[model samples]
Target chain A: MKILVCISNVPDTTTKVKFTDNNTKFDANGVQWVINPWDELALTRALELKDNAANGITAVSVIHVGNASSEPTIRKALAIGADDAYRVNAEPTDAYNVAGQISEIVKSEKFDIVFCGIESSDFNGSTVGSMVAEFLDYPSVSAVSGLNIENGQTVITREIDGGKEVVSVPAPFVAIVQKGIAKEPRIAAMRGIMQARTKAIKVSEPVAIDSLTEIVTFELPQPRAKCKMVDAENPKQLIELLMNEAKVI
Target chain B: MSVLVFTENWDGKFKKSSFELASYATKVAEMLGTTATAVSIGNVDDSELKSLGNYGVKKVMCVKNDSLNVHDSQTYTKVIAEAAQKEGAKVIIIANNNTGKALAPRLSVRLKAAIGSGVNKLPLSVNPFVVVKRAYSGNAYAQVALKSDIKIITLAQNSFELIETPNDAAVEAFAPSIDASMVKTQLKDVQKQSGKILITDAEIVVSGGRGMKSADNWAPLSELANLLGAATACSRPVSDEGWRPHDEHTGQTGKIIAPNLYIAIGISGATQHIAGVSSSKFIVAINSDKDAPIFEAAQYGIVGDAAKVLPQLVEAVKELKGK
Candidate 1:
């Protein structure tokens, strides 16, 4: 079985987010970049499925919808054991455009399943997966916590408000993995890092989309008020403070 | 110029966030000098739908259908898009829950509107169309401008303050012309994990991390959760160990929740873990490491051992409840 994992380059979660130049765009200076945490789950799950395949999964390929600046991220995905990588040579301006490009790629590759994070840590929109699925006319499930592949069908467990739902879909579906499905993302080993450089990195152009979502400005959240500490060894005092001072109760 | 809200319901009961989103939509409608109407689908009774009027809704369009109860995304999108068009709603609001997150994008395509998810604040500019949205998974804020004639926005769970004032309104039963093809995917079964309340709807949540020592000790935490009528969650490490189901994992990778009271025990708040629970109204942290990053996020913190704190907190809750 062939799998396509979509990865996005996002600012590391630890970065203190800020905006510059009248807050029109995110400030790029002094920011460390990493593959989105949820995307790492998708990638790792893709690898696991490949390793556990009975008929022998051919390869796991990583794809990113971004410009040349995102090469390192695509390379990192390869180093983490993707057999090859593809970088769409375009800046992702909107989720529709991103999905359009992936749909075009999906048309050619005919991958058995596509994997993506529930949402990018940066955009946090959680749209691209479903959009891609809709564009391809394939079944899609989001926030999958458990996955099982058997008898040419995949069973996935997802959460709703009061309970859980376990759904099954045939192969050639799309799954957006959330966190908690896998342990810490495996780090690229020395041998895998060396092998990644030799793997093929394909580039593709984005398809045309007339409409797009726009970002007007980006800003840091208002600083939280300073924490008010209470005296320890006195539970009643803390309760009093919560009732009288904070007035939350 | 009317505003539309999708009332989230599960098993024929409206979720609290639905009323909260309706309250928010009411304000947005008032800001635009128009009325807000709600569109809901489920097996909900009309009398229950009438209660939505108290949230300042002028009317409630109840789409009572059995297929709607399971939250079929494709069918929902078709129905909601038609409702928006029929009502001539310029702005649509929905809770940023799992269903809303799945439906908003599809509705955007059908309505030809620019969509924004995880919206936290009111529009900065209504004319040019800007709303502040949570970025970097709530670590930062971004103002998104939807340069379109129609707009759809998903309000972040627990972001807006809810208000209550009575309004005399009518509940109108509306039937949507849903295509059979839209209901292509069928729900086989719903397998819910048995434990505390579902995290998204919980008023109080008690979460732990790797510091709980072993999975066997989870009983006390569950006991405390039951006492408070709270939900039980875990950091990534606990879920990784299979001590808890991944669905109950609250962190950057798991479900993002915003309960009224979040009591985190033995967990050092990693940025990833905090990403999911940052919107909780009040946070209480209990950890041995005083300098754990979780302290930075908590409103009230206790420096102690979980082994000692768990039973004590359970007892405290039980005493308070007289149970």
Candidate 2:
């Protein structure tokens, strides 16, 4: 069984977000690109499943839809333990277009399972996984926190409004995972890094798909007001201010 | 053409989010010079369905299918798509909650419509179909223009206010053809955490971080949360350290919450942590360091050790509430 984990190249979590070109584009200058945090966790969980011989997982592969600049981030996934990688050479304009590219890859590779992070930290569209499932007519389980292959059957656990539900989905399904899928993202070992240098990263041309949404502009959130300080000696005064001035208590 | 709103009910009862969706859809319909129609699934009461009229829905299409009683996203998408086609809806609106997140993308694929997910406002231009949504984890906003005849939007939770524009809404039963093949996933078991306010559903949140010192020091924070009837949350480091459950962690990689009031106790507010909570209406920070990054995002700050301050704040709230 092969698992295809979708990877997204995103700015480091600590980079201060900015916009350029009259706020029509994200300012990429001085930004450190990394694997999206959620995707990293998903890759870690996929590798963990592959490590256990009981699961009979043959390979864990990673795929991304982006330009050449994103190849480094894709290499990081391989270093962490993806057996191979696929880079759909194109700019991910929107979720629909990206999902289209991924669906094409899934069809060609016939991966038994596909894993996608619930949402990427950059756009936070939260749509590609389900869209890919629809494109492939495959079963999808969203908000998945736990997944295991038991007796050759895939068992999944997902979060609902106020509870958690255990589910069972057939093969060739998509799992939109969030946090708790793994304890922590696995770091690349020196040996894995060396091996990744020789791993094949097949660059494929993207299928033709028109992006449905266009970004007109971008704007930064309003700056917060100066904080009103309350002395530690008079903690009650803070409550009074909350009740009267802030009216949020 | 009408604006279609998908309203979700919890065991025959409607929640604030449904009303908010109805209100938002109605306003969008008005902007388009059309009426708003709502489609409700599962076993909702007639009176409950009628209550949507208070939020300006002109009609309600109730789908009483037991197979859809449990939310299968594929089946729900099919049902909603059928309804949208029946009504000839030019625009569709749903809440950007868990269910909507799962359903919208599939619906978009099935209906051949463009989606603007997690939009916080009404369209800036109806003709061009431009909507604004928070991007980059609320650090920036994007003005997205949808280029499709039918547009689907998932409204951000707590972004729109509930407006009461009472109308005598007509209720009609809708039965779309659902097949067994559409039920792709089966729910095996469910576990609910009872008698505790979930952080996502809470109006106020009191969050702790490493500055709380240790797991033993969480008592005062929990006590303050109980006193304010708020939920308890933690930073990622706290959850990673096993001081709190993973579900209690709120950050970019964790649960993203937008409560009315968020109190940060001993958190220094990394950019990722702020991303999850920057949407809160008001933030209060209590930390020993006056220059903690959390203060820059907080409206109120108390520069003191959480150990010395949390108990006093709890007492003050109790005294104010006469508890």
Best by DockQ: 2
lDDT of 2 by residue, A1-249 (tens): 999999999998888999999999999999999999889999999999998999999999999999999989988999999999999999889999999999999999999999999998889999999999989988888999999989898899999877899998888999999998998899999998999999999999998997889999999999999999999999999999889998988
Off by over 4 Å in 1: A52-59, A170-172, A183-186, B66-70, B193-195, B216-227, B308-323
**lDDT by residue for model 2 over B1-323, one digit each (tens)?**
99999999977898888999999999999999999999999899899999999999999999997788666887899899999999999999998988999999998888878999989889999989999988999899999999989999999887888899999999999999997667878878988888889888788999999999999999989999998999999999999999998889998888888888999999999999999999999999999998899999999889999999999999999999787
Task: Give the per-residue lDDT digits (tens) of candidate 1, residues B231-280.
Answer: 88999888878887766788877778878788888899999888888888
lDDT of 1: 0.80
Residue-level lDDT for B48 in candidate 2: 94
In model 2 chain A, which range of ten residues has the least summed lDDT? A154-163
- lDDT tens digits, residues A1-249, model 1? 888999999998888777778877778898888998888878887788778757356889988988898888888899998999878899888777787788788879888889888899888888888777767767677667667676656777776666668777666778877754566787899998999899999997777774556877777655555555543453444444544665554
Can you tell me which runs of candidate 2 are displaced by over 4 Å? none
- Candidate 1 chain A: minimum summed lDDT over ten consecutive residues — where? A230-239
In terms of docking quality, how is candidate 2 classified?
Answer: high
